[model samples]
Target: MLRLSRLTDYATAALGWMAERPERIVSVADIAQALHLEAATVAKVLRALVQAGVVESFRGATGGYRLSRPPAQINLVTIVEALEGPLGMTDCAAGAACEHALHCGVSAPWQRISAVVAATLSRMSLADLARPVAQRRHKEIA
Candidate 1:
């Protein structure tokens, strides 16, 4: 099963919390405390986000992090790609060097599936993920 790494998961949680206070400069400690996460982990997550242009970091006594853009503009793919790199769902997804590269039966189908997944992620934003679980629902897959 494909799943995001724990670091990426923490990044989404930290980002979702920050999205709630988009204008505020949030310390890693504060976010960690509020989200019941580790300060070091949050710090690391924020660093990746900053590098990805997903969030901005401030420096000074009051230095912290804030969303570089509105939550609606920062989509899930941006976050996932920030720490995890592009979404390559399979060994054959990215023209990766593999024995299967030559006439692989599943390569084309899997790449198509990966594209659809990426498109879905593009439509999902940080704001959407920030909603409470009870307030968020998904249609059943047909």
Candidate 2:
């Protein structure tokens, strides 16, 4: 099944936490406690996200982490790619040339499907995720 890794899930959670308070710099410990996650794991995930430019780290007592850009500017595709590399629906669909590349009919179709899935993910921005659940609930009720 297509799914994000635990690290990816944590990265998204961390970013979503920051998005909730875009102006505040949240320390790793605080975030871990709030999210009920392990600090070490969150730290590792944050480091990866930092390298991806998804988050910016600060130093000093008041230093912590914050989103590098507006939520609207980020997307699931970029975040997932940052945490897990490219999204692929099949093993051979992962940009690696196969010996049966020319003889395979299923690989081509799978590749096309993967492309569509990736494109759909690319079209959804983090802003969509940042929408408060209460707001979504209200919309649903309406």
Candidate 3:
């Protein structure tokens, strides 16, 4: 089954939390407490996010993290690539020239699928994820 890593899930939750309060500079402890996750895990996730240019980090007494860009500009593909270093269902899909590349028939198809998946993810932004369930449902219905 296709699945994201636990860290990726936590990263999304943490990002969604920040997206919900984009104007607030939130400390790691605050995010952990709000999400009911371990502070260390949240810290790790935040570090990755900071490195990915997704979140800006500050230092000092009131220092905290905030999104580098508006939530609407941060898409799932960007987040996923930030954590996973690019989305690839298979080695061949990631542009790794396999030994069988010359004879492989599925390589092109897998690449196409990967492209579609990436495009779909690019369409989903953090702002969308932060929306209330009722609002999301209403949009879907409409």
Candidate 4:
């Protein structure tokens, strides 16, 4: 039952929208309107992204937000971590102390699985998410 939070999902959608128009400075209101999400939610997501250095914010009247780097340079791992803190399949996998740590034999396996998940996410860049399905498949096939 592993899943991303609703806010994280919105953040990805917002980021993907921006990635498609990387050269544009997009207002939060516009993003909210386009994504049919609440303005406050979009603002919150943008603030987190800005704090994480995933997106840069402009503070002028005509200012808005844009990605801090190219889509290809930003991976899902970075985005997920930025939105969700860190990817961990279990408490121990995230380095938290567990009451059963001494007796836990599955901890090592959980850590390994977490590492593989992290690596898979790292390999998937924002550019991949931004592209059309056909384009992504073509790239994967080539």
Candidate 5:
């Protein structure tokens, strides 16, 4: 089955929360407490986010993290790539050294599928996810 890692899931949850209040600088501890996740895990995720240019890191007193850009500019593709490197449905699709890539008939199809998946993810932004699930469900119902 296709699945993202736990860290990627945590990344989405953490970024979604921060996106709700983009102006506020948040600590890992605060995010962990607010999201009911482990602080250590959140810290690692935030560090990766900072390196990915998704979040800005601050130092010294009152130091924390803040969104590097508006939530609308931060798409899921960027987030996924940040945590998981590249988005690849298959090893060959990700540019891995597959010995059979030259002769593999499925390589083209997998690459196409990967592109479609990436395009879909690129369309979704952190702002879209920042909304509370209940509100989104209510809107869907309406």
Candidate 6:
């Protein structure tokens, strides 16, 4: 089955938490406590995200991490790429020149589907995930 790894899931959760309060600088410890995640893990994720330009890091008594850009300007594709490098359903489908790529029907279909999936993810900005859980559920129900 297709699924995001636990690290990616945690990254999304952490980022979503930060996105909720974009104006506030949040310490990794506080975010870890708030999300019931390990402080070290959150710290690592934060550092990587900062390096990828998704989050800006500040050093000081009152400094912490904040999104480098507005939620609307960052999409799932950006987040996924930041954490996982690139988006691809299959190795051969994502421009990898494999010996069997030209002859494999499965590769062609997966490539087409992967492109659609990438497009869908790229279209969903972080702002779309900033909605309250209740509101999101309401929309899901409708």
lDDT of 2 at 3: 78
TM-score: model 5 vs. ground truth: 0.92
On TM-score, the stronger of 4 and 5 is 5
- Per-residue C-alpha lDDT of model 5 across residues 1-142, encoded as one tens digit per residue: 8999999999999998898789999998899999999999999999999999999999988999999999989999999999998888998888888988778899999999999999999999888877675377569999
lDDT of each residue in 2-118, candidate 2, tens digit only: 678989888877777777777789999989998899999999998888888888999999999988888888878888888888688877887877888888889988989989988
lDDT of each: 0.87, 0.84, 0.90, 0.91, 0.91, 0.84
Q: What is candidate 2's CA lDDT for residue 94? A: 72
Lowest summed lDDT window (length 10), candidate 4: 129-138
lDDT of candidate 4 vs native? Answer: 0.91
Q: How many residue pairs clash in all the candidates, one count each?
A: 0, 0, 0, 0, 0, 0
Give the distance in Å from residue 22's predicted Cα in candidate 2 to where it truly belongs.
1.4
- Score candidate 3 by TM-score against the native: 0.90
Using TM-score as the yardstick, the better of models 2 and 3 is 3
Residue 75's lDDT in candidate 5: 92
lDDT of 4 by residue, 64-127 (tens): 9999999999999888988888788998998888999999899999999999999999999998
Regions of candidate 6 where Cα sits further than 4 Å from its true position: 134-142
lDDT of 6 by residue, 5-108 (tens): 77778888888888878878989988999889999999888887887788998899998999989888888887887777678898876677799865777987
lDDT of 6: 0.84
Lowest lDDT sum, 10 consecutive residues, model 6, at 129-138
For model 2, how many clashes? 0
Which residue runs of candidate 3 sit more than 4 Å off their true CA positions? Answer: 133-142
What lDDT tens digits, residue by residue, belong to model 1 across residues 30-125? 999998988989989999999999999999999999999999999999899898887778866854778857877888888899889889999999
**Off by more than 4 A, model 5:** 132-142
Candidates 3 and 6 compared: the better one by lDDT is: 3
